[model samples]
Target: MMAFFEKLERKFGRYAIRNLMMYLTALYAVGFVISLVNIQIYYEYMSLDVAKILSGQVWRLITWIMYVPEQNVLFAAIMLVLYYSLGTNLERVWGSFRFNVYMFMGYIFLIIGAFILYAVYGEAASVFLLTPDSLNMSIFLAFALTYPDMTFYLYFVLPIKAKYLAFVYLLIEVYSFIIGGVITKVSIGLSLLNFVIFYLMTRNWNRISPKNVVRQVKFKKAVKMRPAGEPIHRCAVCGRTEKDDDTLEFRYCSKCKGNLEYCSDHLYTHTHVE
Candidate 1:
């Protein structure tokens, strides 16, 4: 796994467009500021209309991530903080490039699914066409799902896992599916699909092949290294240098030794009783 990741890091590098999660957070903040001045501007620019994404307005798929309704200032702020914290951690772990790829891939998949839905039901069938609320919430739901175990203080008092919170949010969306608006239902479905696609594509299971291959190569290289002329110091037990030198072939036993073979350091370290 380490080798595979190292190879990938070498190919992709630490700094790339993907590692710009911080930039995304900043852009989202700026979008909120501008949209607060005029909410309809967000709708016109950021929200991905079925027609727009399909008509090669590719930015629509990604720009929607920055779209937060002007009226929901507090809600958007809370969501952005959570996303920034988790996204930064994820970027550090995966490095910037991989995390960016992970997120953008999710966005791409969601857009593709939306396109398919449009093909089946026609452009107006999209809930996003009717309202942008569903689109905004999908981005939030995707981040929450990615780092579900992340804990946050509920009401600044109770600690709760984001996953549990996500579950509740999902349930709410389910209720919305039954009684909530059409756009709400579409958002819920797309958000869930986003999580599934990301989970599958970046999964550890798919990594096993590259990981094992790199390990095998490393093991082979290690086995091939010869144990060559390693320098040895005195072996105190017998008072002889284990290291071979060119000029001397000193033997240590009483029968062969003319001069006492003990190095000065070994003389005090051990006793040879006659």
Candidate 2:
């Protein structure tokens, strides 16, 4: 799956939207304003009502994302900021295309779940209850997976690790699934399917291991011990240094003049210097 994502990035990464989180944040802001003006109006028109959708209100499919989770103004503000931080950091870690794929796959899973509920229960289904909570949970789960040791102040008081918080939330979700209505069960299962799939695919547990952490710390110290003003080997074309982008290999180009180096990206395609 990661190899498939790599292939996708090579082919389609250029077209991905940068800072996509900002747009998603903006939508939440819009939803907040809409809620202030007339909450019922937006919920009636925009909530993920499959019955209404089948009745030709197709816009609900996309517009339902604008439904912001209810919270006090201060809490909402804090939550939005936290979500923005999580989302942008994930984007930086995963790159634009892969992050986009992760988010959109979550959305697709939710949609499919809703449709399945509608088919099973007909008009009795209330899958629209899922919405923004499940979506937001997925984002949080991804952040916890990526930065497990990162600390947050619980209620601006006690410091707690993100992984612990995520575990608590996961437990709550499992409990909800066991006791909740059919809609809730479906929502929890289908909405978090993205996180489950992503965790399985990336398998980044080794990155958070104590051994890996010590190894990385030692490597950084070694790099820092190097003499000041020493030139680090970097790709002449892309300007990526091994220190910054360890995934890339830099090689001196014998075919090029003036001690030119190139990374794997430009090693072969770059014009040879005379």
Candidate 3:
């Protein structure tokens, strides 16, 4: 899937929107204002009603995303700012093209999932209005997966890691899917399915390949055969091992494609292994 995305990038990269988050944030601002003034207008015209869609109100398919997820202005403001940052950072790391693909795929999934519900429940599905709530969650989940160690403030107070927060969210979503109605199950499943595919595509599958298996055997043998006093952890650059200084800390670079460790002194200074 990653390779397929790369192929698409090569072909359509020119059309990718730069500063895409800026546009999304602008729409969020519009939504926030609407929520402040008249939210009922959104439910009547903009909300995603599968029944209306099937009845030829197809514009609802896209306009529904324009409604702010939170009704409170303060909460809505926070959501807008939080997602804008997440979107921009993701675009920076993944490139404009891949970021666009990730976001648009999420939207596509929601649209398809809504239709699936309509098919299963018929006219009853109209009450299950899909919002951009799950889509925003996807953005946050993607950010967490890409930069798991990144820290966020909880209500501008306590500090928490992105991975931990995503875990809590996943648990909640799973519970909701298990206990809630058919619409909730379908919605949560589709959103989570998007994240699962993104996660799989981002992973280094070669680690489980036959060549890596052979290399692992060789690496283990080398580890055992080395001098007893030799340190197991060493920086890829500068060749300094833990044996050199007890205070020197080492960690694997997350941005690097493979397991490349670096000592604290060189961790941020050295070029990435790619």
Candidate 4:
């Protein structure tokens, strides 16, 4: 999967927005203001309402991303700022392309999860799990897991290791899923799935870093160059070289003289040239 992800990064990396979280944070601010004016306005039009989407209100698909988890204006401001910091740090560590993929993966999953919720409950699953809060929390979780020992000042006073807080959050989500209603269960499930995928991606952050990828490419080229000198094995019967097809296995024939060899395809059938 990392190899496939790298192929995508090479093809599409340049198009990724640098400091993408800044833009997202700005959008979150906009959402916060809009909510202050009228919280119901977003739900009425911008929510990912499948019924509305099928009815041609397709803009909801993209617009629903603006929803922030915080209802209080002050809390929203603080949360946005916190996420902006964590997001920029992640981008610095993983590079913009990787960070972009991480964030967009969450969005895509949220959209898909919204559809699943709709299918399960139709209109009854009104509790939305598509808020930017869940996405940001996923980012924080990734960051914490990546830098487990890193310290965070909880409530701007108590200092604690990020891993501990992440553990607590994980427990809370698990408990919520176990005890919450249908809507809460679905919401938490979506959020956990998004984080799980991202956690897999960032398990070995160094492997995906730009520097590491460049090193791997250089090493691959050097190794390939060494193998270009001459063929190590060749078929005595069909004269097929190892260069022709790597999957073909070659072995020396005991019946043949002068160290003759044959590829797997012709090995058993070839006559001995003694």
Candidate topping lDDT: 3
Q: Model 4 misses residue 109 by how many Å?
A: 1.0
lDDT of 4 by residue, 1-274 (tens): 5556766877998999999999988888888788888889899988877778878999988888888666886788788888899888778767788788888887887778788877887766566435655566778788786567678999899999889999998898788889987656666677778778766753545456676667657655755776556776778878888689765566555446565667755653466685
Best by TM-score: 3
Please write out the lDDT profile of model 3 over residues 51-139, one tens digit for every residue.
Answer: 88777889987778887867786787788888999999888767787788777788889998888878888888778877777777889
lDDT-sorted candidate list, best first: 3, 2, 4, 1
Q: What is the TM-score of each candidate against the true structure?
A: 0.56, 0.73, 0.76, 0.70
Ranking by TM-score: 3, 2, 4, 1
Taking the tens digit of each residue's C-alpha lDDT, what string does model 2 give over 1-274?
A: 5456556778998988899899988988888888878888676898888888899999988888887767468877887899999999888766787678788888888888888888888887754445867778889888887667778899899999889999999999999989988778777887777888876775535445676667657656866988986546678887888677654556555546675777655753467799
- Candidate 2 residue pairs in backbone clash: none
Candidate 1: tens digits of C-alpha lDDT, residues 108-225: 6556666666877786654545333444454446556545655778988999877787787778777888886645556556666766665565454522567555654764575467
Clash number by candidate, in order: 1, 0, 0, 0
- The C-alpha RMSD in Å for every predicted model, in order, reads 18.5, 7.8, 5.8, 15.8
- Which of 3 and 4 is ahead in TM-score? 3
Model 3 residue 182 distance off true place after TM-score fit, in angstroms: 2.4
What's the lDDT for residue 35 in model 3?
74
Looking at model 1, the pairs that clash are 19-96
Alpha-carbon deviation at 91 in model 4, angstroms: 0.8
Instruction: Estimate every model's Cα lDDT from 0 to 1.
Output: 0.59, 0.77, 0.79, 0.75
- TM for candidate 4 is 0.70
